[model samples]
Target: MRSTAHTDPVLTQSGCSSTAVRALQISIAADKALVAEVRHTVRTALESWGASVIADDMAVVASELASNALKHAGSEASVRLRLSEGQALLEVDDSSMQRPVARRVGAEVEEGRGLFLVQALAAEWGWRYREDGGKTVWASLPVPAGSAA
Candidate 1:
């Protein structure tokens, strides 16, 4: 897996204007390899942003989202990580319109638990269709206190 990232100023949503901060985005390949790559990228990004406390949670959520995209969509995905106003946002874009379903699996089951884990880990999670024949699944996790975006 190969990725590229950059930091750019992002405007705040508050009515009062405020300073912008950097966000991270990476291009993800559509393969089983994406799972590890997503986890690693999330960890690295959060650590670099001074939010290592939430790195483990964010990485798990990212892996679940990216793995689902590659397994079901069969197309490359893009991941974006941003910290804004005390929240960490993660988005995974893939070329599939099929919304993810979270199923209740038995303890013995080895599959059908991805979305469930995502819902359990993320503060919020959802999906939206793109105009260009694809969709993006997004999750949000709160940034730890004293952490910088």
Candidate 2:
């Protein structure tokens, strides 16, 4: 098992106190069948962040974002979970230049509601294209005030 400590130079030299737990980064191929596993991984990361109390919302947003990446974006992707400034951030990176823009849909449609769902559940969400390639869709949800697990 990996020790829960910041062993990287970036974390050690950044002046980031151990008081603020280092964030978790999970990189994996964007597989549709692994969505549940991705959600579970985010929940575990949140718990490791000492934010297990509000993990429910974080997990939902994570699931939605992962699903969006798998469905609309490419299979090569990554998920990152972090705790900072009294909030939790979930980021999904996929190898596609296309940013996720909301699309209108008819009631009869069976799917295509990923971004809408993310918008509803997350405190805030958006996307940014990387300078080299690809893009990331990210969301932030405030940890419940006064409840830091």
Candidate 3:
């Protein structure tokens, strides 16, 4: 695991370390209501970047990852978004050091499907131990050609 995220903007766990054309980040206390705010904020940022093509997907991925951090990590969680040339990167970090697992659940099940949703929507997703003492769960989605990433 990378000891610390780069200072330019604590980013990655993914190999796409290309400079971000645009970026934003925030940290919120563990609260269910705040999850919606994170979603909206991330969506707005994408829209401003002219990346409406992936707005909804980015919102859902952002909220789901935020929810996981709040519910599982049980501490303040931070989210970072980086739009590069070919992809939009979303990362959620929490104080807990434990890694996340993605599992398949039956349709009848109503819970434990957050990671599943992410897997379905994200082109690539994974987690890494943060040098500071937590784990950052990240996902990358393709940005269509001719659109700002």
Q: Against the hidden true structure, what lDDT does model 3 obtain? A: 0.84
For candidate 1, what is the TM-score? 0.88
lDDT of 1: 0.83
Model 2 TM-score is 0.81
Clash pairs (backbone) in predicted model 2: none
What digit string (tens of lDDT, one per residue) describes model 1 on residues 38-127? 799889888887788888999999988888898889988888888766788999899998888898899998888989888889889999
Once superposed on the true structure, which residue ranges of model 3 sit more than 4 Å away at CA?
1-20
10 residues in a row with least lDDT, candidate 3:
1-10
User: lDDT order of candidates, best first?
Assistant: 3, 1, 2
Each candidate's number of clashing pairs is 0, 0, 0
Per-residue lDDT of candidate 3, residues 50-137 (tens digit) = 7889989989999999999999888888899888766899999999887788787888988788998999999999999988899999
TM-score of each: 0.88, 0.81, 0.83
Error of 1 at 47 (Å): 0.6
